[model samples]
Target: MDFEKIVSDHKCRSCIISVERYQDGGFGNIRVVAANKAHREDSERVFNHPFVPDSPYTDSLPQDKNFEDFMYRCACLGQPLHTYVHVEHMGLWVNMFLLPLESDKENIGYCLYSCDISPYADSEQQASLSAETATHVLEISIKLQGAKKDDIRQVFRDIIEDIRKICGAEHCCILYHDITNRKYINFCEAMNPQSPLQPDAIYNNEKFYDIANSFDSAIRGSSCLIIKDEHDLAWLESVDPDLYSLLLENGVKSGILFPLKHNDQILGYLWALNYNVEETVKIKETLELSTFLIASEIANYQLMKQLEILSSIDILTGCKNRNCMNNYVDDVISGKAELPEPYAVVFADLNGLKRVNDEKGHSVGDSILRTAAAILSQVFYDCDVYRAGGDEFMLIIKDGDVDETSIKSKIGQLKEKSAIDTDVNFAAGYYIANKGEDIRTAMRLADEKMYIDKKEYYAKHPELKYR
Candidate 1:
């Protein structure tokens, strides 16, 4: 075959890749057999060297397993293919196509590999998937587009179920990483009713993050991992024996794993186990496009949750802020949230915040506030405690969990423990209420008793009368 003339006929960067075929149906080293002037110039510009024909592809491009797999599938397997993928590690988008060619030698199979590389992703290229893929990906985007953070779990389950069916897999799951907290959150999962694999709580284990992270080496910079047979499993075992053992235990004989990523950040992983191996390319194409949209949705969900947390937390004391307390109060008042037959409302006002702020500084006052909150949290661990502005905190405790005597005893402990961080004291009071008692009235009574306790504290030490 006149491979040079074949490449020269095209104006774009085009080349011929030669694949060594074995009689046992396995492939060997893939080499670049020829390249056009356009391809040569592009290579020279990137590598700062003249393009040398008939050399290993790695001689010009980085050795990538995904690129190798695409070449083998097209040249040896005789499948024409097109791919638009983000090479995230390299910060480049690769829009490439492949077509099998007639080979003159029996031992050597050939393919035409043409590509366009860009720093920014092309919207048109990304939307150029097959009709079926585009339709399904669009459907996924629509489902995610309408999801709210609180309802994302159900939406994710629905999406994962749909993806599992599309892949003909026995089990499918999406696991997200809370990197800042070093935790794993199982977003959702779907298992075929007849699947041999049993449900596992492995993700909940503390050691699983280390096991999951080990897959980075096995993936080796590929867009996804497709493990089809024993050979792949052996490679996986060599890379991470723990993961390999777990996969076999879970009956993961064949699978495809895609990293859900957004803007170069890996948000999580999506995997389908015991999938239809015959549809490997199709699965890859589908997930490559779909996970892109899924990742965006997940990122949005994380952002929403993060904002809520930030808004509801008191930065100085690390307690629920007044806004959160107000919301809870409104819910109870509006009958959106129900209270038990008997409950206690408690008020705790810091005794010496103004003194600390006036004498030591606001920084020290803030530290003292944190210490006071820590004491309250320890004493009322089972109750709902909120910062009710300034140095006052309120707690709503269920009577079944504790009686008024226990509440008073806990408040005393809270005062004693406050001494652990500076000489702090809390003027606290509680009001026990039965059914039909209003929370606002309970709060008023608690606050009035708290003032009485404060007056007694000042009475004991007349020099601290200002408190």
Candidate 2:
């Protein structure tokens, strides 16, 4: 199937469905226009499926392109798709698909005619129901839309509980794919009241590991399967007897595995077990939902991860910035349970940043700062290095025995070496923390010493400009 095209079409239909939801929690009827036979069939199947009561397409079919355009506009304006549907009883008005019951997936098509129940039914009553449905649909959309992994699991758990209440299939389990671990991990499991398999302890069983590995291989290969009859369950049982026993004890007779893939690369799988429907068809429905949810979630995850990385990184040099370095400083200074000797803080100020930036350009100045950071990191051990600001750097060297004289010798050598290859030069001074000294005082002392050393160096070499 041309899944991209399918997704595009569904996105369009979904926009319309959202507008319908806002019109009155789908109490009024809605219609969807399909791009092809497959799209229409898929929409209808999703709408009619008994287990998916919240699907947006249960009752509506699109009549015209104008209505489709209208729905898209509403969605753009922030109308959630699951909260309302548009419908006209007299003329061809836009209609949205809706599932009626919170637990039932079947669509009950209702238009203004059906909603216009008895004239005697007060306007107040109609308004109340409309408001209630709108609120419910909004809540459902918020819960399902852009959900995280935890959110997805919670929604599935709620769905399973609802299913158990309606279908008498008290025992259920969901296996969601953990992409990083390359395995299908159980998210939630609902067990029969009389079963010996304790719900809390079932996840700890070794059989879950075997099942996860088996599903991981299949998911990696981009395949989904349904364990329909006793034979399939028995086959899995033979691989891990404990899991089989647990399922059998809990009255689990069927299961469905749905692969989640992006661009033919399987990212994960979702396995639903012990539902009322035949294992095969339920598996198909699950595959559809899994595809939608996984695609949306992976996109969201990638975006969030990128944003997080960017937030912590320095945009210029692509390194850990001041914010991250501060945390590192705090971690080291606030020693472990047992306090040891205080560490040393090295304060460095680049001598020619303004000159480099003014004469050579800011790019060269930035390069010099980056080079200084690299040199300091290479030279120090167990230290916190920071680009304190433009052309200024700081280092927190832990538990070092170096005195003022030795540190000065090291800095002098680094400066002489740097002048040979690069125009970078910096004056550095370090102060070891005393018993009662704080960070600020230590830094102040270091800065003062650095300036003194810089002054003396210029005094001896009268030709060099000190400032």
Candidate 3:
């Protein structure tokens, strides 16, 4: 019988690995000779290699004495063997069968077939454990879904703690990427109390970006990454010595890092450190279900925050809008707000806005508004600046001594600066409120005084008077 042909013709769900006896009495290097289509794809994905005829078996087997002795017994006894084995590298439990092939009354080789039986191992117990973990993850998802913006950090802290426990890890942390700020924020973290690693730590260095870039390139489409030893750290060290040293300093002998992806974008990374091989496998499987929910929750929270910001900001001037002003007023009126004593209100309107809009077009008028807002922001840098109306802005000085003359000088300098380019001008008035005075009364007085300033501004420059 043609053994290779017969193996190729045999169709089953099992992946077949074949080994031939060598002249030295030991088996030749094992090779994957045949597998059904389904097994072929699974083997390639999980083991990271295709099962081609005569190709060396590269899948890592269980690293235990029992497995080594079992294989020895099978080869020595010259009898068919069958048993359950676990592939440590792939983190899979498989049902294994070995059949000896003979030629001319001599054993020449053995055919080994393995079928993945991980799902059925202690089926009842696994089902119960899976159900419990699922319920816990669902609870976290629900809390994130309903969480307020202020509560998100606490919720993430709880998630990190739970993940550390589930993974049997010494430490776990979530690193959030602040793209705009160009920093990696440690959003949350948890650690075993007796573990040497510090839970509250920051990694803010340019070298971290290099390490992240290298890691992102290496694991482009992979779901997770595991680093078991110094060999792994060598690659990291080649890319970034600082980052490698940082990890080593934290006592990270073994660790896993997985991306929190949303809509094809990586928002952050989740990391677990110092988990044993078995614990690492369990954590990987558990996170396979949990990370999706976590990513969705984070995405939703970010969306809500962005929407809130857009709703309360003036798109044209980049200042807080009238909507924000109304909310502030409501907060003060309802006694839910407190202002530092000796506050002041400044009301200002852009001069010659109608003329700029009519003569230079609305685009120029918009530019002038933005420039005016920018100047006000710089001058009243410590105050709340709001776009209160078309061509008008309000500043609420919550605390600080009122240097009226100094503020007027800054406004005069701004007017001169704008005159050289944008040719814009400002008419402004301010009213300081005593400790017991009503804020609204002070604002009204400031508005009235602003009209007086506007009249004087137009009188000095008749060419800018509104038609």
| Candidate 3, poorest ten consecutive residues by summed lDDT | 60-69
TM-scores vs. true structure, each candidate? 0.91, 0.43, 0.73
Candidate 3 C-alpha lDDT tens digits along 88-177: 335455565665544342433445454445733443423333455667666766777777787887988988898888878898888877
* Ten residues in sequence with the least summed lDDT for candidate 1: 198-207
Per-residue accuracy of model 1 over 259-315 as CA lDDT, tens digit each: 888877889899998999888887889999899889988888888888999999888
Ordered list by TM-score, greatest first: 1, 3, 2
Q: Give the number of the best model, judged by lDDT.
A: 1
Model 2 over residues 1-467: C-alpha lDDT tens digits?
Answer: 23233335443233113233333222233443223334445445645533222334434342432233234333333322221121222222222332221212233322110111121324333233344333443443455574675466677566545434333344555555566765556655565576443444545655665655565443222234445556557555665565567667655676555555555455544445554543232224234433445445555655576787687667765556777766655654685222244656777777756767887898887787777777766666456567676666777655555566656676766676567645666677878775767666777888887777667766776764544
How many clashing pairs per prediction, in order?
Answer: 0, 20, 0
Ranking by lDDT: 1, 3, 2
lDDT for 398 in candidate 3 is: 76
* Model 2 root-mean-square deviation: 15.2
Q: Could you tell which candidate, 1 or 2, scores higher by TM-score?
A: 1
TM-score computed on alpha carbons, candidate 1:
0.91
